[model samples]
Target: MQKNYEYDAVVVGSGPNGLACAIQLQRSGLSVLLIEGSEQIGGGMRSKEFFPGYLSDVCSAIHPMAAGSPFFSQLPLTDYGLEYINPPVLAAHPFDNGTSASLKSSLYETANGLGIDKGDYLDLMQPIVENWPKLAEDILGPFKIPKELIASLQFGLSAMKSAKWLSNRFKTEEAKALFAGMAAHSFLPLDQLSTAAVGLVLMANGHLKGWPLPKGGSQAIANALLSYFESLGGKVQMGWMVRSYGEIPPAKAVIFDTGPKQLIEIAGDHLPSIYKKKASEVSLRPRRI
Candidate 1:
C-alpha cells in the first residue's frame, strides 16, 4: 500500500520564523506540515519563570522592534487574542549615580528629557524614524541588490557617531548614561561604534513606537499560528525533529528554517559543488570570532 502521510510543504522548526513561513504557506492553500523539535514552540520569544512570577525573557526581553514592525502589524495579533502592553517609558537606563534616562513612545518627551542634546538626538534618529517601515523591510527580509541595506549601514554608522559624540557632549551624567545604555543592547561594550549604533537604533524605535509585551505569553503567537494552520487544512507534528530528507514527509518544496550548518549537514549530497564549498567556508568560520 501507499504511505498514509504526506504534505505539499514541510517546515522544520517551530520558532517564530518557521511558524511565520508555515503560516504564509498554509494560507496560500498548500498542504503544509510543521515539525518541531522542542515540545513547546516560540523559540527565542519563550518566557520562563526565572524567580517565580518575575517571568524573565528566556532570550529576547523586549518587543520594541516587533511593535514597530510592519509585518507584525499586519498579522493582527489582537484578533488572535494577543494584546500588547505598551509601556509609557519604553526603556529606562538607570545609572549608579542615582540618575536614569529613558526613551518613551512620545518623541517630544524623549527629546525634552534630553534637554540640550534633543536636537542632536533628533538629527541622528529622524530619518530612520520617518522611514521605519523601509528600514524594517531591509533588516528583516531577504537581501536584494539596490536594497536599503547600504542606506541601513549608513544609518547605523551615523547613529554611532552621534552616540559617541553625545557621550562627551552631554553636560549631565544622566544623559550620557542614557546613550550608553541604549548602545549596550548590541551586546558590545560601551566604546565600540557597532554597539553605539545598536543602542541608538533601539532608542529611536522606542521613540517611534513604545516597547510592548504580547498579551498572555509569547506562546500565544505560536499557538495562534498553529491554530490558523490547522484551520487551513494543515497538520502539525510536535516533538518531531527532521534529521534528514528521509525523516520528512514527501513534499513538492521544503522550507528549512534551520541554520545553514544544519541544512548543509542534512542535504550536502544533493547540493551543487559551488554551494557546498561556500557552506564549508561558513562552517569553518569561528562561531564566536
Candidate 2:
C-alpha cells in the first residue's frame, strides 16, 4: 500500500528560491513545508554582526537581480517590511588615473561618465534596456521560444561575443574596465564566449531598476518573504538537514535549492542514471582556474 504524504510539497533549503517556491505552492492551495538545514531560516540572505555594531550580509551584498526580477516585482514584500535603498551610483570602477566610471541609475548619466565612448555605450545599452522585461524573462530560464523574438535575437547575437570583444567597442579605459568588471562576475575569463551576456544583463538591470539594498540588510528581504509565507499558512522547519531521500517525509513533490553536486549526492540513486551522470558532469566552480 502507498503511504500517505504529510505535505503536497516539501522545499529543501530556506533560501530565497525555496521560500518563494513554498509561498507559491501554498498560494496555489497546496500544503507546503519549507525546511532549512541551518538554524537560520535564510540561507545566503542571512545577516549577522561581523564587527562590533556593524551588520554584514553573509553572501549577497547587492540586489540588482531582486530589483529587476519579474516575480519579485509582483510580490507585496514592501507591505511586509521590505524596504529597498537605492544608492546614488549603482557601481563604480576606478582607474589608475584617479578617475572613476560609475553606473548611475539614469542611462544618460552613466554614459556621460564614459567620455568619448558615451555614444557607443548608449547605442549598445539603449535597446537592451528598453526591452529588459522580455529579455530578462527569456534569458533567466531554460531554452524556449521567446516572446520577443527580435529583441531576444539581438541580445543573443551580442551576448555570444566575448567580454574583450564587447569592451573593444568603447574608446576609454574606464568604459572598458566597467564592462570588464561586470562581465568578470560570471566567473569566466573575459575572453571566453558569452561572457558579455552576464555584463549586458547586469547593465540592463542597473538601468531598468536601480540596484538597491534591502534596508537593515539582506536579512530584511528574507524576513519579509518568510512573513509573507507564514501569512499564507505555509509551514517551515529549521535545523533539519536532509542528507538523503530516505530522510525526507513522503511528499507529492520536492524542490531542492542546492548545488548539483549535493543534489546528486542526496538523490543519485533515486534519479535516472543518465540524469545522475549529467549532474555529476556539471561544475559550478570556475573552469579557467
Candidate 3:
C-alpha cells in the first residue's frame, strides 16, 4: 500500500536556509510546501520602511558571509533582481585620535594601513587569505577530513588561540584594536579561545570579497530566493504558524529551520525523551538569559 502525501516535503520557516531547502527539494522533483509564521517571509533578511519612504534593514545589514558563501554563489539570484553593492572600504575602526584602521579588499592595502605592524599583519593573514577557499570549504560546514591539510592546520592553530593571545602578536594598538573589534562580533569575551577565529575569518572575507550590501535592501536577497523557489514550483504559505507536529500538512518529511527550543515545543513526545531532555537542558542554559 502506497501512502498519499499532499506534499513531498514541508519546510517550516522561510529564512534563507528554509527557502534554500524548499527550493532544492522542489528542484529534485519533490512537491514542497514552505510555511512562514509571519505575514512576510525572510526572517532576519527582511527590511521595512522606518519612515515614510526610507527603508532600513531589520537585521543583517551587511553580508560578508553572503558574498563568500559557496552555496549562494551557485544560485542565479541576479536573474531574479538581486544586486550586491560592494563598498570601497570593507570595514573601518576609528581611534580616539581620529585615525582609523580599515580592512580593504587587498591584503597588502590593509596591511599598509597598520603602520609598525605591517609586516606582522601580512605574516599573520597572507597565508590564510591565499588558502581561504580550501580552508572555508573544510571548516564552514560539519567536521570532515580536510583536503588541504597544511592550510587547515595553520588556520586551526591560529583560530584556536584567544583573541587576546592573537592581539599580542601585533605590536601596534591600531592592529590589535582592529582585530579585537572584529572578534567582538562573536559575542564572546576577547580572552575566550576560538574567538580569534571569528575575527580572522571576517578579515579574510573582507580581503577576499569586500563585504557587500544587497541593493535596495537585504530583503532583496530573500525576495530573489523566493522568486527562484517559486519558479521551481515550490509553494509558500504565509502566516501559517505550526504550533505542533499535527499542524503540518501530510508530507513525506518535514524540515525545521529553527532552534532546538522550537523543535522540542513542536515535536514533543514524538522525539525520544533523552533527546528532548538534552535539547531542553541546552535551550534552558544560562546563555539564554
TM-score of each model, paired residue for residue:
0.81, 0.95, 0.94
The most accurate candidate by TM-score is 2
Write one digit per residue (lDDT tens) for candidate 1, span 1-289: 6554468788888877887788888878877888887787767767777698776667765777767766666675666666668866777878787766888887777877887888766666677677665777666567555267666776656654634554776666667777777776666545554456666667767876678777656665666666766777877888876777777777877887787777777776778989877866765322332
Give candidate 2's TM-score. Answer: 0.95
In terms of lDDT, the best-performing candidate is: 2
2 or 3: which has the higher lDDT? 2
* Model 2: residue 272 alpha-carbon error in angstroms: 2.6
- Candidate 2 lDDT over residue span 1-289, tens digit each: 7757899999999988998889889989999999899998878899999898999999997899988988778889999999999999999998787889899999999998899999999999999999888778677888999998999999988899999999999988899999999999888988988999999999999998888999989999899999998999999999999999888877999899888777888887888988888878887665752
Candidate-wise lDDT, in order: 0.71, 0.90, 0.89
- In candidate 3, what are the lDDT values of residues 150-211, reduced to their tens digit? 88999999999889999999998889989998999888878888889999999998888779
The Cα error of candidate 2 at residue 258, in Å, is 0.9
Q: Which pairs clash in the backbone of model 1?
A: 182-199, 183-199
Clash number by candidate, in order: 2, 0, 0
Give the local distance difference test score of model 1.
0.71
